[model samples]
Target: MSTTTAAAAIPAGRTEPDPDRVARGKPLAHLDGVPVYGWRGAPPYLRTKTQLAASRLKVTAEQEAAPLAYVRTRDYGDVPLHDPAAAVKMRPLPSSTKARMAARRTCSQCGKVRPVVLRGRPCSVCRQRAEKAEQRLRARTCAGCGTVRELPYPKHGRCHGCRQEQLEAKRARIDAWLAEVTVCAGEGCTKRRGSKKAARAWLKQHDWLLSPANPNLPDSWNSPGWPRRCTPCQKAHDAEQTRRQAENQARYEREERERRERERREAEERVRWAAAALADPGVVVLDTETTGLHEQARLVELAVVGSSGDVLLDTLLNPGEPVGDASDIHGITDDMVTGAPRFSDVLVHLTALLDRKRVLIYNKWFDIARLRHELELHYRDRAVREAVEEADPAEVAPEVLRERAAAEARLQAAAWLDAMTFEDVMIPYSDWVGEWSEYHGNNRWQPLNGGHRAAGDCHAVLACLRAMAEDVPAASGADEVSGTTVGEGGPWSRCA
Candidate 1:
């Protein structure tokens, strides 16, 4: 058995060279055992120039055994190796430590990490010391009545009760002082003593000398003032005077303009009323047919007969809604009104044509109510609904609902023809017909076609009016005929 002893080696206290210094030197000649180019005089080795040059040409070689090198047939070939100096050096990776180190410095109030310079400083502590100092100084002496009192902050400068009493005493003193001094009698001027002296100096500069003639003159009057009054009072008084003059001028101009407008309006009104009373040259009788007796029912057809008794305008309005039983009488259908403009669209044209024109209908009340109802519905007025509900239906004669609908169709057509009302040119011929019949000892009036058809009914009304106009003749005088019309008879009169 062979025994091996472990020997104790001596420790070398050599330190590693600084990396920054090594980088500043020449290229490395060798790292570990690999051959490389570097500064010859660096680190552990130092050699003469001749020896160092000689070492650059020397190469190391490994010796093989004589028998292996001389083999008759060499099956293995030597491979060229890459230079060790050409290999890249890799840096060691960073450590994966995850612990957090506590900071030495922190804010006093919030315990947050603070910079070294701010460790002991606190804003709240400094503020408290400053406030305490201020409180002490303020309490050292009282501002009012010269009395000393202990109070917090600014209030320490004075005691509350003493301050109040001192203010009252000072006010009384000032009032007594003011009472002894003479003041100018000028408006809003209450200068006294020192202030009066300043005012007198101002008057002297303005070259205004006190008049010996007027002993009771205001101090401001001692100055050569503007033509009106004292300097202080002049500005306000002049401004007021100017304002009043402007207001009076404006009032007069407004009154003149309004008077002219009134005269013009009155003149125009008289002309229009007179023109409307006279018969228009081209008048057309108009009427309508509807789906139902109610005003809510849509217009079915419209008809218009010219003053010459010609059919000027006639058309069917196919209300988008159903016609129901109305179709049996007028023979209109939904397909007929499919492309027609809504009532709202047509209302503008209708209103223009009827502007200031009186409308004639067989039953004026029923036609007016239905037309007004449709207008209100299209316009979407709540007030119209209220008015309709409050209206007396009996007076309007609900019995004439269907007939009135036909009348409205006619009126709409006639308005489209000439933009005139029946009241403007046409009077109720039925009254005259009844009067004629009564004079001939006949009790009954002429019969009106009941069913709602646009063309037929319109023609009937036109014929009645024409026949009456021919028989009665237009009056030359302005006096209105009374006993000759409806609603003019006694309680039991046949005409009523």
Candidate 2:
């Protein structure tokens, strides 16, 4: 009978309720007026169950996807989550909340509160007051009398009396130190001190060590006696001596060169006088232009015209060297004479033309000097070489050799100015023409058309000669035209 009451017949498929749900209890819906379960609510319950299962699956997936130790919660509109701990207590309002909160703050410096109505910015009275106080503190005060005083803003901190006193004290200290000082043994050291200790201190300050034998002297100042000079002074003196020596050497060389030139010129002048005596022509004009005013400058161009102002054998001779300053005045560019004949090529023609013809020139000394140098060079190269080659070494004695050399040099120098200068011919011609023109009431002695061109210059000289010839008085067997009066048709009419 005890067994018969058997546990109400259990259904074959039925099982026990979940143990986890029994422990956790059923979850409640957030919506209002919703039942947990029943027939009328069965559909919703089933649907909720299905949705819950799906939601559970999503939550599980989210949890799996989320970073470790992270939690997720649902949001309810307009309903804050109740914190269990806070719900247990009831606290009073804080003091900060009970007071009327300030919208605009008051300035600490000026005690002025800003109005809430003003929107842009607050007042800066505190900052402005701080800046003005700083400026006042920086304003000048008299240092001597300790009184506040007005001064230029730039010099606001210093008073005139204090500044002057500081300068005077510095100067007095410097003078005192200078007066007590002695020259140091060290090179270029002019430092002074009052005592041996101070001197040692100074040497130590300057990183100098005292000599072992002479404790007063620095190691670098070990020379036997007082130095002839300090390093800087010695350097300057040596430089000056070098400069003076260079200058003296230059001057000596210059004087020697000038002496040689003078001797050559004298010999050339003698030869010119001899040539003029032999030729005895009516007129000869010599002209030359040079590269520079130095003895070494080469001749660029030369011209010799006759009394009739004719260029007897006019030729452009190449100097065989660079044309320098001479081209500046003469306009003889290198291109103008590139294919011109060399001086050596035209020398024979030049010499033949000058035979029995007086030489004339302006500034004869300079012209002759340059000519002499050029001719001497050519003659030595030509004649001296020939003589040396033809003579026997055994027969050429020392005296004879010397004599031959001297004679050749003289000949070379002579050729430079033989009937080839203004002094010998042109000057006399000019004088004669001038006098004759003046006598005839025609005082145009200078070359015509300013004489810039060579042809123009020769024409001027020819004109003068013609005038002179016309001016000559009639002589026995002279033409009637020459004897005619000045106003009549005659030589004078022809000259005019």
Candidate 3:
């Protein structure tokens, strides 16, 4: 059936193609009332476009087979089809078609139209003759400079020498305006012009040139109120500006002195407060075991030992997740902390135990920062949990809560550290041992027993601090002599 009849027979809603039914390489035939044929259903004798071409039955524009219709997501409609024919007769190509193909191989030089072996070039014989003739001509005389020089193969209009001379003459015409003036025409100035181009560039950079029209005339430059001074005058002008800047700096420094003095007094007050608190029996040594060395790592264990060697607070904390690699360092694992209270659960009691007492920490900055981070996470998680519980518990996403909590935790942790101070045992200990430069070999004081675990490290810091306090009077704040002498004999050798 024809395409019009086939399309009319299709259902109204199915006017567009059936995507699933659309296929490639299917045979073209009429079946019952529809026009669709499967590739397997075709006879062995009937062949496709490729099969027909393989047998040398050329199918071109004029000898095309009837088109076959097919359906796709949208109706692709019909495509031209080819089939095998008996007693195949190869027709002659059209004259116009032959002419177009012949034109593609034609050469521009030799007007002789023939089947060219090389597509664009003329016959190789003609190309060889032309190359030979070009090689015979050695040099060409220049028209502009009248210089004769050997050039490349094919002789052309002007030589490189002539071109260069023309370019230089054009540049000279362009620069003719730069040759008239010699020295600065400004009042109280004596600087002479250097190279015309350099002087012009310098004037432009300094904004001394008022107009570009007459650059050679210094009278055309600017002096109006502003410093269009010569080189020497500009140096004097710069010195004046520097002196004024120094005066301004002095005035600013005077204003800042009062504020500096006020800060110094406040710092002294903090120091006195810290010293008095440290003298109390409640003063504690603190340390923590963290997931990793990173600032964001969760705390897995905390231990606080009092100044008199009493353990105040020592606990393993369930860090909400697994106890990370810190388990290796502190010997606290996820299984060990499975029944332990979280940091939040012990926050109130921990705060009460340490309040109003100075804390001595080995590497106070690291411990205090990690402590603040843990506290921030505790508060942030609580906030998220409360919000989720009040709203739809089932709809709450844990990941979303975690992201919001992390941001809040970061901001709160920084603010948390600002409110508290911890005495750093590392500072005073390092001072007593002298700098690493003063200490020879391994004689410099190291952490006692190399204890990284919280309870053990706390004890170590306390021991070091006690040792430092005893040696303070003899050191007089600089113990270089003993520190260097003890060389590899160890920190205790000085006391011995």
Candidate 4:
């Protein structure tokens, strides 16, 4: 709303001159029909609102329109300029004015009136007294003299006399100990300190262990475990300790090397044993593609690959229940296993393959638990009740009987599981892979990367077995058949 134009009040097109600017003899600019003046540019007769207030005068409503103008400055945007003649003196208030002013000048602490008003009530004398008292309270007591004293280093807690006394006592102790100093440790050189103040200074220069400040050895010259030897002896002892430390470190490193070598040899032997086992035709590699892992899982597909890389059995199974959340993992669905054989139907063939043979399963607990769960489901079925019931094992209703059969199936499954001497290839493979785990205190189980499929994992286990048998460096099961993708090109490329 404020503008700064040239000092001339008239515009370029205006023919007429501004009469007010001519009368005042000061340049004035017009803003939206009102006169505008720069800082200190307004005529002396005009005063701002603050100036009017300082003069105890105010412009009334009647003086509003006669000569309205604005003064503009850089600091303040726009100020209303009024004629001093138009302002009236303000009415004074009538309430104990002198008393209030007197109270402000009076110091409340001592009731003394000063020329200027006191700040925050307290007088200088009271403030000084409080500061001095606080300093006195904070001053330390000298430990030896028991007198309060101010010190540059207050933490020392000792005055000049006490500190000097302690220093003299330390010198006395040093002189006494110097008399007892005997053999020097300078390699058959018997040079010893002369029992004098010079000897004490030499001890000080070398930072000798026997000092009055040390609580243990400084009190008596013949104290047990005292360092009675000279500086050379101390240095020699330090050197001997350093040598022992170095020897111990070297021995520890050598033992660590031997331990690592032993572990390496052991891993190699285990791998060799694994390789020989895989080469055996009796060993079968078992793998399963289940709905989920470790809990409430039902297998959608099961597989077994012979040690020679022959596919002994590979079949999809109708898990009866939904495939749960693992459809993306093994790509198994209700549609894929709609007409597949049930676990009960496939049980005989699976048993025949595993029967009395050293069963090799990758992550055996997961697959075996899943198979056992499936057996429980099979026994729980009403159709199997006729077969499960030999002599009415439980005297209960059909439902309860099925439950009892299911319970008994656990023992049967345990016996069935015990019949096969299964070895989890994952543990051996992980050991060969050499990925240790602090949490389990064993080598971490390596991921198969077997494409999450029953057939793929079977090939993965078979490949791992062959690698260990043939002395391959990387024993990861994922590297199928000579570290290449299983069917693409490998030693057992077409065998599967």
Cα lDDT computed for each candidate against the true fold: 0.47, 0.49, 0.61, 0.70
Tens digit of per-residue lDDT, candidate 2, span 1-496: 3655554565658886755323232323322333232222222112222233343322233332331211112452212111121222224446674332232354444546564322223457656778787677666555444556565323424466765675566556444433334344335566432344544456556553322222233323222343435667667778989999999999999997676455334433433443443345555665655667788766666666766456765555577777766677667767766787766777777777766655555445766777777777677567656777888868886567656765797686695565543443344333333334545664233333324333444454444344444443321123344432222123232111
TM-score (C-alpha) between model 3 and the true structure: 0.40
Quote the lDDT for 372 in model 4.
Answer: 82
On lDDT, the candidate that comes out on top is: 4
- Please identify which of the two predictions, 2 or 4, would achieve the higher TM-score against the true structure: 4
Candidate 2 lDDT (Cα, whole model)?
Answer: 0.49
- Candidate 2 root-mean-square deviation in Å: 37.7
In candidate 2, stretches whose alpha carbon ends up further than 4 angstroms from where it belongs are: 1-284, 387-407, 415-456, 463-496
Residue pairs in candidate 4 whose N, alpha carbon or C atoms collide under 3 angstroms: 275-469
- Give Cα distance to truth, residue 490, candidate 2, Å: 27
What is the full ranking by TM-score, best candidate first? 4, 3, 2, 1
Candidate 3 Cα misplacement greater than 4 A, ranges = 1-278, 389-415, 435-445, 448-450, 476-496
| Per-residue C-alpha lDDT of model 4 across residues 1-496, encoded as one tens digit per residue | 2345543665767676555433353436676677787776676667777888899998887655544677777788767788788789988855798678877888777787777878548777767888988666556666677777555335545677887897777667665566545434346656663445555555566564544345233433343444445677778878999999999999999997677556656655766777788768788888888888757888899998888778989999998889867898778888999999999898888889999788888888888888888877765563345645564646556666656667777777777877888888787767666655789977677788788888788888877766666654423334533433211222321112
Candidate 4 structure, TM-score to reference? 0.48
RMSD from true fold, candidate 3: 23.0
* Ranking, lDDT, top scorer first: 4, 3, 2, 1
Model 3 C-alpha lDDT per residue in residues 1-496, reported as the tens digit of each score: 9999988997887667555344444546553333554433333344545566667676565445342322221344332344444326467779998877777667657756766644667776688888887554434544445565566422334566665665566446435434423354345665654457754565557663333222233434333432345677667778989999999999998877655454334333433443444457868888888888887788788898988778888888877777677777767878888888888888888778777777788778888877887878777877677667776657867777777767777777676566555777664455345435444633244454535677888777666655544543333313335432211123541211
- The estimated TM-scores of all candidates read 0.29, 0.31, 0.40, 0.48
lDDT of 1 by residue, 1-496 (tens): 2233322232357555665333334433443333333332232232222333344421123311111111011343221222222223334333432111112344455555544434445445555877898767766666656665454425324566765675566545444433433353446665432454544465456443333222232323333332323456557777888999999999999997676455334433433433332345345555776777776787767665554556755666656588788777766767776776655666665565455644445555555555655654444333334445766777766445434445554555544444445542122333333334446654234455634666676666655554433322223212234312221222221111
What TM value does model 2 have? 0.31
RMSD of each: 35.5, 37.7, 23.0, 15.6
Q: Is candidate 3 or candidate 4 better by TM-score?
A: 4
